[model samples]
Target: MTSHNRRKVRLITALAVGTSLLGLAACSSGLTAAPSDSSAMSSPKAGGNLRVGIVGGSAKDSLDAHSPVTHPDQARVIQLYDTLVSYDNDHKVQMALADKVTPSADATTWTVHLRAGLKFSDGKPITAEDVLFTFKRITDPASPMATATSLATLKRDEMTAPDAQTAVFTFSAPFATFPDIAAQYAAGIVPTGYDPKKPVSSGPFVLESFSPGQQSVFVKNPNYWRAGQPYLDKVTIIDFPDDTARVNALLGGQVDAIDQLPLGQVNVVKANPAIKVLESSTGSWLPFTMRVDQEPFNDPKVRQAFRLIVDRKQMVDQVLGGHGTVGNDMYAPLDACYPNNVPQRNQDIAKAKSLLAEAGKSNLSVDLVTSSAAAGLVESAQVFAEQAKAAGVTVNVKKVDPGEFYGDQYLKRTFSQDFWFTRDYLPQTSNSGFANSPYNETHWDDKAWSDLVAKAQATTDEAARCDLIKAAQEIEFDRGGYIIWGFPNSVDAHSASVNGLTPDKSGIPLTSYGFRNAWLAQ
Candidate 1:
């Protein structure tokens, strides 16, 4: 994997929701106004009870931060742990538990200054040994909870924590975005000796008790580096497998906060006098990611034609209920790096047919595989089928169990000519759509395209990196390896009393809800 891909992968790929209910009328931007050096609401007053609920629970796959990919697990980490660095509301990196950070002259070498007298909730000191052990374990292939693949671009080097307050990292190359990478939950600092079943973290709250398929409880961490923080003495994170149940819990006042409110329920919540719905555009993309290694998809024209048939507006309007911003050609529209003038994919039946004919293809009948569990996903599949048919393509919609789809089936079928609809971030999805480079999930390997992605991921210069990412994005857009339908603003509902909610570029916008600066409306 190139540093370019790794740069994007530094972010999480999950839709985050909170499970607590407060009286919120409209869900505005959840941003923290703390100075660059501090979180605004950090008064260090740690005590009180906060009950939150999540729409769905996490599966067993990819829970390890090193190899982790699942949303629930990512959210879990963000909720219970703290990274060395974190992002402000504007996507800028900020200090979290660390007191200060100093990067080397080459940007490849860096050091973290941990706050003094810090300790995990378990009462163990947050020592440099813990930081060293955590990184070492994550880079190790055998660490049970390791999610190392996310850091594949980096050469394995030694991490040294000379003292409890200082952690140093030496990289193989100049990584300008290293600060951003530190904000990822996968990079969250764990207990010196992390135990999977018995977990401990140097964060605001302590995992008092955990249940595999049920509720997990968090208690305030008095030793939290930030003094007098974690206002809520106890936080109950209940897992409601269904969004409705989660919503119902919120409406009935069974929970204080709720995450993952269904897209269709936006109106219901807006109409409800007692409920509050917060909405914003997410950096996440719901696209028809095609594997380029397979037959038919190997031709960029063929892929472009298929994407042309998609009625993106309809997906955002009818299927999404007009609550989201349509992703214009690129995977995400709001990211700072998107190219504005790129040609968009309009629903052109005639053009699609012509392109298909140019490819000298068959009657164009293929299976559109997707998970039925994801909200609005089934409706999206049906709509795309109708749209593609207008351009002489027949889509056989198949509802595969998400578990199977994400497993070996996705990689094998994706690279071998099978088509599927999956949710992912635009930058990471770019790699998955083509198989040019080694990690290409679609196995669509093009040397030129690979080179662009490689440059985009590794180039230390900001302007240079942006240009390369844009070029790679254009290549994918022009050729049609990804049929990005839309980049809908995600809606996450929290009680009006709940404070300090912020959204990050990463889809999991549930961080920053510590409520230390958030009072229960005295």
Candidate 2:
């Protein structure tokens, strides 16, 4: 057995034994304790409106909770609606609207039990019927939402709400990790007749006013389920598309917090004792996507040559400003199933040249499309262009506007860049790994790889699922079109007076922009 397999065996054994101890602790406490983070130090005091500065927003932003396309949209959605489940600081799944979610023995069916007395901001009781409605709209064939990809296996016709508080979902195939999917940021629950124009929230806050690309204002939800939560009277999220203005907003005391702090400004911000910077290690990445079906990259040797030509270490150090770890041409470094045992791929100029020559492209030139949409994309592309010169390759870096980059030519580009937040292996793959993936920028499509992913998703046993996932990862490591060079840290900042902002591995800054727990210290 490999070291990865051995680790899985030990983990399963430990989980089996730990269940008894967990039961004992629950019995003693009369409830299962929620996971806690030690990063939050002081007690919270309430009653101040918090203003947060977020990066990147355009007029294309929408109030639709299910299809948030910008950082500001995502931040607003989290406040206006609650997902069934969410990731805590450590990236473990935790209950939100649903108190408990139980899977059937075969992992094909799931039952969700909502917390008693839950109500929408408008005072209507939150019910399973609403949950069913929300999901139905999300998976509607004619107009599916962003989360439809994650729920592709869901058997929409078999869904049922047998009681006001209980919802049942049946899938076309076994889905052992439904909770993780439920925790997606875009999977916010809504009412039966929900309207984006006039929203009813089940979350800690209710939308008061919004302006696309400008700002959004929210008021505390009086009917919020969590006790004494959403301590603030209001929240205001302002969009500062420019990094300099965003950082300045915090320094000037115009905003209480800011998300996606520029790596170049980390030292400058840290030097200010009045400000507190929270840094969390994340699985987030910005990869150079090479279309497998296109010229130059269509040949396996050419793909291999490009992969070897990248100086992963140099990119991580210079492009990320030493705020990240090197990537080995694979994603989901934080996932348990990630094949860490695979030998790390590094720059080999001689080998890259040889491979290029073998592919009859001894002197190759390619256009690398990139944009300033995300924080390090353009710089990474430029750095990579410089590094490719060592392997007899002339890389032409083409910078496009953020809006134009993700516009009509998004997935159609033969070579481009894309950004992703930290997600587990299966969910991440569902978005970008398959033939029909909505964001499959690389255009990678292989039956063998897809079959392995399907088997892994269907496997109820954790160890067996991980084994299948490792095998799939190995295939991608060998021939995948992504040149994943690094995983950057999520750096966010807030005023010293702000409490409850802690490090979160979700890669969304400020604990997935969870201002519900944040309060102004007196």
lDDT of each: 0.58, 0.78
Candidate 1 structure quality by residue, lDDT tens digits, 1-522: 111112113253221111010101112311112344333444434355667776444344322334433334444565566777665454455567775666555556667787678788778888777877777776664542223433445555577778778878877765444554455555678876577566676777667776644676777777777655656677777766566788888888888777657887878877876666766555555666576657677777788788778788888997778866676556545445667778776788788888889998647887877663345666778888888777878888876654445445655554212211112223354435344221344455566767776555455555666677678778767765667677656567777656555544444455443434433432
Error of 2 at 246 (Å): 1.3
The pairs that clash in candidate 2 are none
Cα lDDT for residue 195, candidate 2: 98
Which 10-residue span in candidate 2 carries the lowest summed lDDT?
A: 1-10
Report the poorest 10 consecutive residues by lDDT, candidate 1.
16-25
lDDT of 2 by residue, 35-87 (tens): 43323646667798999998777776677877776667778878888878766
Give Cα distance to truth, residue 15, candidate 2, Å: 13
lDDT of 1 at 407: 46
The C-alpha local distance difference test score for the whole of candidate 2 amounts to 0.78
